[model samples]
Target: MHTTLLKDFSVSAAIAGFVTVLVGFTSSAVIVFQAAQAFDASPAEIGSWMGALGLGMGLTCIVLSLRYRVPVVTAWSTPGAAMLITTATGVPMEEAIGAFLISAVLITLCGFSGWFERAINRIPMSIAAGMLAGVLLRFGLDVFISMQTQFVMTFSMFCIYLIMRRFSPRYAVVTALILGILIAGSQGLLQIDTVRLQLAEPVLTTPRFSLSALIGVALPLFVVTMASQNVPGVAVIRASGYTVPISPLIGWTGATTLVLAPFGAFALNLAAITAAICMGREAHEDPARRYVAAIAAGVFYLIIGLFGGTVGSIFAAFPQELVLAIAGLALLGTIGNGLLTALIQEKEREPALITFLVTASGITLFSIGSAFWGLVAGGLAIAISQVKR
Candidate 1:
């Protein structure tokens, strides 16, 4: 078993895993931090939040990927965290924890009951592909957008990425990342001085359920996580052509989040964006070997959990443009694939285009994200077309 595992692992897979963690943490971690602060959590409590979330994501990503032999990644719900920042204001920390627990319970129920998967399955693949494309469109655009401010670094990474894609496709993202880091370091853009090594200790908060929190915080968190995060997450997995069982994936993440919520794991769900980093061909030439990338990501998540503060500071030290450039470059393949799949079916093309446009527009309504709205709009378009037919 050990020898087989060793054989399956590759340098490209490991680098993909590292990039997954880097993009996941650097992108929305600060919003999570702000959400913690909204509940008036202390610094130690915030670290505990990071620790619990890291542990939950790590466990799910590793165990699920190994079990299914697919790149099954999990992440904290960024939309849920954003909702918390607004709704958790003035809510006691204890009550907020209780709300987190409630949200987890709801997610777990949805998973075990298989309702969420059933609903997701009804949505046609083209529509799902459109939603996935919309969600990823920003990252693809950001590769060039980063050039506006950091032309030397971003453009160099982009050129290296294209060159690598033409010659050594498997190593393109990793090569681009290395070049970006080297250039950023040379430009004195890396803030290496501020990172301090510190072990994160979990600080437990006992649950104190309140009606207001349950109604205000828990329900909204649950809704946003399901609609905005998990929906697109499942879409990514399917669009990538992986048939891993979605119910168990959702169930395990909910179970993990439930276990860690008291320690500040607000919400855990399937990962869409970072999962693409691991699922794409860039992770490995053979799709069967791509599970190694998810396993590698799990190891990195454990490191982040154990040394939450240190890892957070390390991610923070990198220049924003470098992160943006690398992420955009890494995801280029997945985004292009999504767009192609979305428009391939003539019957679904128009609706899929609507979904893509609405999603890329980044419009939010009733606190839900563009992903959910895009799905709704596409679904409606399909319904209308059927009626006309």
Candidate 2:
């Protein structure tokens, strides 16, 4: 078993895993910290939040990927954290913990009941592909956008990426990342001094459930996590052509969240963006071997959980443009495939295009994200078109 695993490992896959963790943490860790602060959590408790989240994501990503031989990545629910920033303010920390528990229980019920998986399975592939393309369109654009400010670094990475793609496609993203890091380091853009090696300790908060907390915090957290995070997550998996069982994946994440909530794991769900990083061709030329990338990501997540402060600081030390450049470059292939699949079927083309546009528009209504709204719009379009037919 160990030899088989070693044979599957590749430098590109490991780099893909590192890039996934880097993007996931740098993009949203601050929001999670603020969510903890909103509930009047202490610094230690906030670190506990990071620790719990990291452990949950790490374990789920590793276990699920290995079990299914699919690149099943998991993450702290960024949308849930963002919602908590507003809704958790003035709520007692214990009550917030209670709400997290309630939300996790609800998610577990949905997953174990197989309802969420059934519903997601009904979403047409073209629509799912469109939503995914829309979801990732921004990241692809950012590769060039970064050049406006950090031309020397971003443009250098872009050129190197193109060159690598022409010669050694598997190493394009890795080359871009290495070149970006070197350029950032040479420019003194890497803030190495800010990184300190501090181990994270979990601080538990006892649950204090209330009807108001259930209505205000728990329900919204569950809704946002499902609609904004998990739905697109499932879409990404399907769009990438993986057929891993969805119910168990969702059930395990919810179960993990339930176990860790008292220690500040507010919500854990399937990761769309980060998962794409591990599922894309850049992770491995052979799709079957991509699971190793997720396993590598799990190891990184474990490191973050054990040394939450230090890992957080290390990700923070990276220059913003470098992160943006590498992420955008890495995702270029996935975005293109998503767009192509979305428009391939003539009957679904218009609806899929609408879904893509609506999602890329980035509009939010009633606190729900564009991904959900895009699905609704595409579904409605499909319905109307069928009626006409």
Candidate 3:
């Protein structure tokens, strides 16, 4: 019955899932890896994170999609990963875990009380879109700049993506990945020696909850994860043409974070750019059938969890230019749409544009990343406009 509207459940869903995780993992898993390095995490602890992240994101997507019967794809919060990389560095692993616990508690409260959902709903969609666009602009720059070093391999795959997107847009990423691999292989850019399959060991870090850690780590983490990660994450979902319970998602991610905190899972929330890939029409033409793709993504995430070491190694083997090209290429559509949406409404246009520019400017104040500041600038713009109007 559902097939009539959606068609090819397992196959399409599997492809969608593969693309989602492949793209998602390739993009920011490194940040998480780096965070682990900062805290001197053991390989097993890192693997545990992969496992927990896989389980948390996979279970959430499966349940949410099944319950809502919408393609409610959940992602391991990208903003949180960025926050950890920037803010959690040098802090003891235990304190990081403590911060995670605190953030999770706060997150659970938000979900249960529904305060977060209400606040998020208040943000104008255009501003949200603008912020997303601003965040992606840096990535777009990397893609082009990479061409100077890896002109042949990166540009070749990029051209393939462009051509494929013009035709079989759904398979654009798959095609790019395959072609990039082949090109990289031909150029000896693929480093197979680094691929090592080892069981990931889980390291238990004792939580040392402290006021300083809470102020320095937890608050910033919660703020960025909620404002930058969850906010844009849900925006990606709604913008991609689906609706789900945001509060419950926050609750679920918080629950997962609480469960995995000891194992080095710092934070988990919905993903924005990565989620966009899975939720977009390119994932599947029929929005109704897209859950299959999300389920597929969950499965891929499970693979990531299972062979966290090997998978991370293999992805790490790829040329940075190759990853940069593919990521930038994949996000082009979402970026274009975000810019357009931000500037659409006349009253919101100036503020939205200002928000976009400020975000794209890559200004970092007080060691805080661009995501939080973009929201601040954008929100301030919106507030000023409302006062005048």
List the candidates' TM-scores in order: 0.98, 0.99, 0.87
- Report the lDDT tens digits of candidate 2 across residue range 1-389: 67878999999999999999999999999999999999988989988999999999999999899899899999999989999998975789999999999999999999989999989988999999999999999999999999999999999999999999999989999999998989899999999999899999999899999998999999999999999999999999999999988999999999999999999999999999999999999999899999999999999999999998689899999999899989999899999999999999999999999999999999998788999999999999999999953
RMSD value for candidate 2 = 0.8
lDDT of model 1, residue 158: 89
Q: In model 1, which regions exceed 4 Å deviation? A: none
The Cα local distance difference test for each model comes to 0.93, 0.94, 0.75
lDDT of 1 by residue, 1-389 (tens): 56867999999999999999999999999999999999999999999999999999999999899899999999999989999988976899999999999999999999988999898989999999999999999999998999999999999988988899999999998898899889989999999999999999999999999999999999999999999999999999999999977888888888899999999999999999999999999999898999999999999999999997689899999999999888888888899999999999999999999999999999999999999999999999999999953
Judging by lDDT against the true structure, name the best candidate: 2
Task: Supply every candidate's count of residue pairs whose N, Cα or C atoms clash at under 3 angstroms.
Answer: 0, 0, 5
- Best-first order by lDDT: 2, 1, 3
Q: Cα lDDT for residue 364, model 2?
A: 91
Choose 1 or 2, whichever is better by lDDT: 2
Error of 2 at 103 (Å): 0.3
